[model samples]
Target: MAIAQSLTTTASLHYTPFIRELFDTLLTDSWCEVSSNRAIEFVEGEADVAVEKLVPYETRSEQGIFFTADDITMKIVNSLAAEVAVEKSFFDPSCGAGNLLLGIAKSYPIKKNLNRTIEYWSKKFGGCDLHDNFVIAAKLRLIALAAIRHGLPSISEGQLASFVRKFDKFYTGDYLEADVGGDFDCVVANPPFGHVVASRSNEWSSGRTQLAAIFVDKIISSGKKGQKLVAVLPDVLRSGSRYERWREKLAKETSCGAVELHGRFSKSVDVDVFILNLNNKPSVVGQIIEWVPPVTDTEGSVRLGDLFLVRVGPVVPHRLEEGDEDFPFLCAKNAPAFGVTFPEERIKFGGTKFLPPFVVVRRTSNPCDKNRLITTLVKGIEPVAVENHLVVMKPFKGGVNSCLKLIKALKDPKVTSRLNNVIRCRHLTTKSISSMVLQGV
Candidate 1:
């Protein structure tokens, strides 16, 4: 209980301690069942110690428990709620501190009867979290929201226990295995991004992926036709080459809705995130939605994938030992940007080598960069080993002149805009590069 107390004490700073004293008073009044059911207890001794003096105990980043800022939470909820009818029946599988649930509750028009409103919405919204404290906090926040709207001075012990009992649908459990029933119309979540070992017997799961993917996949499988889903997910799920199959499968099962990019999760978290909307009604089955492909008005435009044998450089510098320097080795550091150059360095490796008269694009990219594709024409007569951090695009039509034309084509402003739209993560993907059209070439 000490660990739980400290975790709550810390979480309160981020979520605000508006209800901390109320909760402490309520729990001290012997409302222990609400806080201890199926709970994971913490070390007993630390509850008496000051929380600030101790190193912050964070749930592993893989748990994806980064609490959404109030502004961002409201934005996510508002964006999703705008698309569909104002429905009260909603659920958050990984409900952390009830940020998302409170956003939904606020969407309803103010009702005059506070008790009825609190009682009704409590059952209308369904949610589950692995942590008992989060579930308790979510219920309390919902009740407090009602109290604030109606201007109640205080809730008595009996009234507090009554409201807590009404939130029967919100419980503690693993979302992937829990059965939330078919009562909810909208399923909303910010599921964990960490990889989990999915149940091998489940047909919907394909072994390893971010937990967010698994959560969405399970919802799609169990959801009724026309059921709504709104989730905040990592940008990598949108653009990474590794998730292409995931996108394809999702497209096959659900209708394409919308993808709204929100730059960076927050000031503290480095990952970029986006809001995704979907439904069980499949309209564009098996057809991936082009979330943001560069629009074109010109004729005879073709994808670069159609022209070049584009692939990531095969050499992983750190994994291999420095053996005989048999081939010229090129990497992001040695490869000059926007210029043609040859490297004298060589490395020992038995892998695919790119010949001279090809283009090497640095894979390290940021959305804020002036040019998303940092290009260089590697000119030489002999084939050389390129580091995996660079993507190699060998022309199929001609030689060095084709490489030059490709490099020049990449310099176009439209290409930069298009690349930024295709992928915003720190690293570029071969899939995104290959998908870029040879515009203005």
Candidate 2:
């Protein structure tokens, strides 16, 4: 609510009366001239009163509602719009306040004639959301948009007011429970991401189901034949073990592609996310992903891939690998500076004696903290394996003699800082970690 009010206050100072009147008209159907001359003191006081009326919800629900910035929504819609013609109809089953719909509505050329713009806005989009308030908000925004299409400069109070209660742009109901009819050419959204809660208020709230999964299921099963869809979802959906079935379903069922987004929407959201485009007619043969490598230059740094016999953790239960035996399992927490910290709680999973000497580096760290290039030297006893979260760096067939000096070189502050600066997103990957430069360590 404070966010909404802050924006209003800014508009009051910089905007003309006509524009503020238009916005004030949206929030409270009262049409009046906006006054900026009432002094900053008056504006601040009024903004506080307006904020008090808002019914705010905590943003921490497992099923999140991180609204996408308008620019972000425009990009996703434009990407899908590029695939299919924009003149055709589109839908957002989870459209909240109609941002995506409004985004699409505004995508067409700004109208020199309000009638033409209204025609395009009316025909260019349609949507369905679960809440009445969102449906109403979506309509109000479109009306304001209709006023803009008429050219914001020429809008009269009566002319814009006439647009009110006129749009059948969206419906209010659970999108997953029913098909809110429309053979839309495309469906785009930033769907909810996370495990369901137990309020019995939402369909999957009581189960372990992820709401995002349910949204996808609905889009695929209910969409018209050949309908294309673009959505923003938690990155885990692209590769989590539990979601393997979901991937197989797509491989055998629809033509789908996913692109991971780089920087986060805001600092409050830490989870990495990806955009997915799916179609019934096999728009894509298989999955296509874009993974940008993290790279940097340091005085004495070298690519881990160049010297290490990199292997991911064996795909077996670490606990099940426990054969009532003590095996030196290299977990990330066990790395202690230049030496290895073999705590009593080590995972017991020594598969064979053929394992060779190797050094393990922590895979990820807090982005704000030191680029934790914490390396552990494993050489005194038989070589052990590491958890998947750790990158195993071993000598290439005949490249380097020992990982001892390599570990020491990696600990250099400049080396670690350079390596950290190369992060594509917020963490280090074995692929990225292995590609750093190194002095002849």
Candidate 3:
């Protein structure tokens, strides 16, 4: 008997009336593990319904629907397959419960018309997840889905285990350290969100780095010539900050395209996601495409690049003290302090020294709406010294004209709201200070 069948059969004998009812309710509906305090009450009601009906508990304990939002899954699969030819093999580095894998499998044939043969399509699909439970659950889900379509019983556990072993695939391990060897035709994944602090105790410590950025680096390193990749990333990278240098290098090393996804996909984690495609060829300069679903906006369309300018903030060396009048400074501490006064002291400008303008944006806010970029419209005014935590960006070409435009654009309620969640301020530079500025222009 199959493992699922055996587990179900054994469950029938041991399950109580209430437990049996709960099992039946789960089997019939979209229920997964309910841990929320409020959700627990609903589970109890469903359990009562099962008990009143005296239903036998025949559902398999391990079998439950992996909850990946269907809409996001569909978009990701469609977008990826649309970008690349179907004949190319696809891999998901962190394929959570194989939702993306299954979506790709379904869409590949219809979109590309390359998977007419069952064996051919199966060979093209590959995925890996660190969670053993998720891996097993995904294997079962895939086998079940395949069985329904192909008219066969679910694959036996032993057979499934063998399949994983034969491919040298599906071993449980951290994706960061996993050796995914060589380049794949296409790579897709929604890696874990948030920063992973590097400490002496951690095995994967490589200084302090955000987990999301590291995933991008890993994908680039794992990719081979002509390999294509799609990943969901936070909007933090768009700012031309120090992080941009890494992204710029990645872009140069592997030509890449980005598409941003707005709104919340997971109720548990609130983050804006962007889908990035990386290929071995040189990227077309100035090519940026932003896709925000119709639900996110009634305005019809929005481009990710148009909404904001992403750049690194100013960096103040330790030599500059807080009260020193030598330079104007905006440090992280000044943010939210209330009644903090700007120090007004001027120092002599020497060779290669220039005062750059900047705005202090608070880093923590929902949708990043609290952050504002400050630029002075007055010409020939040098920016005060910026302390750490304040980003300084001046017009690259247009002087006061550009600064005015940025300030006007950010003043919008919608844009300001988003800025507040991520940035404390955006600092603008004067025409005289920018590297690109011609002496008298």
Candidate 4:
């Protein structure tokens, strides 16, 4: 006799009479997980009923479907409950598949300590999402998780669904538009938010609206005086000219700091992200902001500002579509350490004399790269024009050998390590790069 897989796996879903009907009715064409290790492949067809037909009148909102990694979820949960046991109400306003709820249970040992009853969980943890399908999925996942914790081999579909619907209280609605209506002690969320997905809002100035910014505004605005809001946010809020106002607001209102994470969290995404912590704690002694404040160690350190007249390249638009001239242009790609691939992204250099023997450094990179500052020495006297992607470092008084030496030195591991703190949000601005302190110039 072959052993069957347990129901604990994310993909290995236990078959239930109600579950099958729920999928057939609501999902209509979604596939169930056959095994734990295998991916839950979705085979879809024409929906028997329209999505709006299944969607109730009360629940209608935009779906930001990005989810958090398991390890990340645990870390957020652990960090939130570090000083105090999170026995109070735990919530994720934009809860997806009950991942945060699971994390909360694991961290506090809710199922282990308090009896796994609908009444207990109902009071302990609650959340809301925009999508009804996600709400259903989240509820089911929570039920399955609870079943495992309670050591129940099999749970009736009707009973499990009833408990989840009654206690979980995860209805489909816009978290920002309407209130989830909870006096939460701990709030942890990793919503689908970024600058690309940002939309204009009447509250802020023209073009000042972003999904993350709006969410942060709402989160901080509605935040109670003595609650903690932990989130995984895009690095845009950390720096950038547009978010300066929000940054000031965040600094004044709550004890906020950003801890940058390493590597890509998922397959499709490879942008730099940070753990944003805002503790609205009553106490002031333990509150402090952690960031790379502008303070260079002046003791034997040579600032890059002294050596070069650093100026960001000018905007040269329509390079490919409407270019009328050909000249050597140095972009970020051409500025590899110790060398230059000049004349590659050829653009109209115009009648301007760019000259040569200038250092070009990459203006942007992910912090995970550790050493994002790639430099190249432009030696040739070709009429060279640089793009905005590179910062042209003109020598105050130097020659070819000096530029080469600077390039070699910058590429050194020690030098890059020193510059690590100076590089913010994977961008080496003219001000930041210039402020970089070198051991020996």
Q: Model 1: which residue pairs collide?
A: none
In candidate 2 the C-alpha lDDT for residue 257 amounts to: 51
- Best by the TM-score measure: 1
Predictions ranked by lDDT, top down? 1, 4, 2, 3
lDDT of 3 by residue, 302-394 (tens): 432332343433444544333423443344554333222343544432212223322233333344334343332222255555444544444
Superior by TM-score: candidate 2 or candidate 4? 4
Which wins on lDDT, candidate 1 or candidate 4? Answer: 1
Looking at candidate 4, what is the lDDT of residue 194? 42
lDDT of 2 by residue, 309-347 (tens): 665555145354554556555566666756755433445
Off by over 4 Å in 1: 1-19, 22-60, 70-72, 80-86, 202-207, 281-288, 297-302, 318-325
lDDT of 1 by residue, 391-427 (tens): 9999997888778778888888888877777888888
Which candidate order results from sorting by TM-score in descending order?
Answer: 1, 4, 2, 3
| Worst lDDT 10-window in candidate 2 | 35-44
- Give the winner by lDDT: 1 or 3: 1
Can you tell me which runs of candidate 2 are displaced by over 4 Å?
1-60, 80-86, 109-120, 152-165, 197-209, 256-260, 283-334, 337-357, 363-374, 382-441
User: For model 4, how does the per-residue alpha-carbon lDDT over 1-441 read when each residue is reduced to its tens digit?
Assistant: 000111122221122222344333322223233321111211111111223344432332233345676667767876767633737677787776566766676545434421355556677676777655555555554544454455433444454445655664565688788666346777777766543333454344346355766776777667677677877776555655466666666666676555544334445355445677776634553434554445557677777789888877764555433346777777765566656554556666554435687888877766666567777778675767777777888777776766765676676676565455544466667876787676555
Go through the candidates in order and give the C-alpha RMSD of each one to the true structure: 6.9, 8.6, 11.4, 8.4
lDDT of 4 at 93: 78
